[model samples]
Target: MPSVEATGAKLYFEESGYGYPIIFIHEFASDMRGWDAQIGHFSRSYRCIAYNARGYPPSDVPEDPQSYGWELAVDDIAALMRHLDIEQAHLIGLSMGGYAALQFGLRYPERVGAIVAGSVGSGCHPAHRDAWLRETSVPSRIFVEHGMVTMAERMARGPARVQLKYKDRQRWREFILRLRQHSPQGMAKTMAHCQAARPSLHDLSHQLSDMAIPVLLAVGDEDTRCLETNLMLKSELPNAGLWICPNTGHAINLEEPAAFNAQVENFLGAVERGSWLRGFPATATIPSLVRSRGARRDHSLIQIDQETEGADVVRLHLR
Candidate 1:
């Protein structure tokens, strides 16, 4: 069991293969084990490192509520890399981890090769800030009152996560089992401070616009909470490319590992080949995709109308 000291806590991590480092950060409901599929696929060609965030088992969980925060999460990633003697690496993070990775890129641009931000931007839109804060406390209180099993069950049934339950019941069961093992106090503090009190991504427009590192913004079509925020990120970040998985949900890496893995591999390939551009081409335009009756419901093909110059129209079919 390899571990690294990160601020006030120690983080447990696992690594495989050897090449350019690729760090994996799990979501709020998951731990490093959530990245098993990704590690299996990427480790063959690249060094894959996944770590359990603070508050998760195998990682130190500070007792004080004040010890958990968004900034600390961002700094923890840096500390882990520094501890491992890694200069720069590609970062892939989901949900909470994604937010940290984005902040890390902003704070340390010179230390990042590329970034994959998946299913992020929850509670980040300005219009939803108030509601998000209020709703976030509900989960925190639940964890404190009913414990991890009760909280895990409720969280597993979230609207954006129901897709996983239906698509793969076995994996969904495993997810719940693992989630139930998390520290209730750690979760409560994380939800209260990190999720409820952290600043929204909308507040970082200036930094996002000036980002120089290549970034891939991925979210499921059914992840309604992140749709608007991800769109905003695509518009703000000059180096970002957006990909919306059809009929997928928040835990996309688990729901559709093949597609997720393929997309990430392609992006990494482009980066390695120096073919990944800084921004969308001047002539490239995203046209509205209006579905025809009887059209395929499982997948969507985006039609880009490149005839118009500087056209940035974005519309998608939503169920």
Candidate 2:
């Protein structure tokens, strides 16, 4: 039960094994246990560190929503790394955590060795941002009042749970119940932070191409929410590789942890060994929606280049 005080919040974190550091940050409303599938496997080969976001389990929550801005969350992570004397470490973040990690990397590239930005995008696409705000904000009321149970039930029914892998109905029910036990206020605060988040990432995108550290941008192919933006990010990131998990949605890591873990291992290995250096997005292409004010609503159908196996591609049609 390791803990650190940062940004007026006490963060709860866990550390396992001993090797090159790898930190896992959970998405909004999720505690550190959301990364259960990763901690065990990676700990055997590398240092695995997972932590609860501020106001989530094992952490403090402020009554004021403004206390939990993205900037503060980013500072919390930076402080955590510094407190641990970790000058550089590999980062794995999901959903909101992914957004935080992307921001962290952009602001402090030298502090990160590599990054696995999972189930998230670079925020360059307006549609992606709108979709995220709408989807996450839609559940703000239920989350703030009833906690994660309602949210988990809806998530369990999403495309990510296609062909359920649960051993039995009882287990699935229990999992959902556990998620329900998550803090309501914590999630509401997170949702508010997301609503206030800025959509532009030009500065980050510019810094991305210059970063020497390797990066992997992964998301579910069925995730219409972030697909457009993820692909946009892949085109701008300097040394990033993209992976789209098939039969999944926004919760790619949770739905296909095995595939997600394998891709992460490969990305980390390539980064450390410096074996693969081929850069994606040979050139940056601006989406017409942002370029032309009077562009038609339906014009180009942008298809995600799903060169990877078992990965789904989401197409965006803009006029």
Candidate 3:
């Protein structure tokens, strides 16, 4: 009853509050419950929805690997919204879910109000394509062979995730506990069909360039795997702004929920007021400057300046 049918599987979902919708999608290692911090905060002002992907428990896991794919994840979001009678909603996702949010923005611009993508672009660097594929694909075999228990042990000690362990032991334990509960078959299918097979963000330059949706890209300074890719995302997406959290790692939201919530709340406000990017996007202005014929923009649409010690913490708002 709390599940919706997608192409080849059923997705279990949860909804809270009552306002303009906000859908929270999870990362590869996480499930719908992973968004508890976000949903708990945003639900006070917005209709918040979170769901377990097709492979996660309570959601049907089709035996057919054909049942899962990267694009299908976006389709699932659309299907979920349609099933709920929602024409459009804001999308907030972390890692894999972040990629899905961007893809959904590209595919159905009409269906998205805005996008907040955190710690996205892991294997998107051109040079890392082959290696990233190998890295991502290997997890499928590992998951299928040793099971989630062993996989969880290995992943809990990952370089980027160590920050979580040191920063919040209890939280890190919670993450690992949930990870161990995942189905090996579902995880294997997900790693193989969804993550390993997904297209690189660099390859989507044209679509990203043409995308007019407002985007907020968040990453961690210690998340070396994603820094370059997030930079690329900022460059390719016209109305994109980026924030780099100093000393943080892969899981930006989980690592810094307080800061994350505050920043996202401000971004959502800006989006609602139609002031996120204002009239002229920075990318559009560059060409305008090259032409040097058009009148300069008198009003400040968006301002970019480094306030904190970290220059990568990009903060944008109408002045």
lDDT of 3 by residue, 175-212 (tens): 89999999999999998999989999999998899998
Where model 3 places Cα greater than 4 Å from the true spot, the runs are 278-319
Please write out the lDDT profile of model 1 over residues 18-45, one tens digit for every residue: 9999999999999999999999999999
- For TM-score, the strongest prediction is 3
In the predicted model 2, the residue pairs found to clash are 149-180, 296-319, 298-319, 299-318, 299-319
lDDT score for residue 260 of model 3: 93
- Rank by TM-score, highest first: 3, 1, 2
Work out the TM-score per prediction. Answer: 0.87, 0.79, 0.88
Worst 10 residues of 1 by lDDT: 281-290
lDDT of 3 at 114: 92
Candidate 3 least-lDDT 10 residues: 278-287
Off by over 4 Å in 2: 122-124, 128-138, 159-175, 198-204, 279-319
Per-residue lDDT of 221 in model 3: 96
Predicted candidate 1: what Cα RMSD to the true structure?
Answer: 10.4
- lDDT of each candidate versus the true structure: 0.89, 0.73, 0.88
Q: 113-178, model 2: which lDDT tens digit per residue?
A: 888888775344664556656666667777766657668787666554433444235435655665
RMSD of each: 10.4, 9.7, 6.3
**Model 3 lDDT at residue 31:** 92
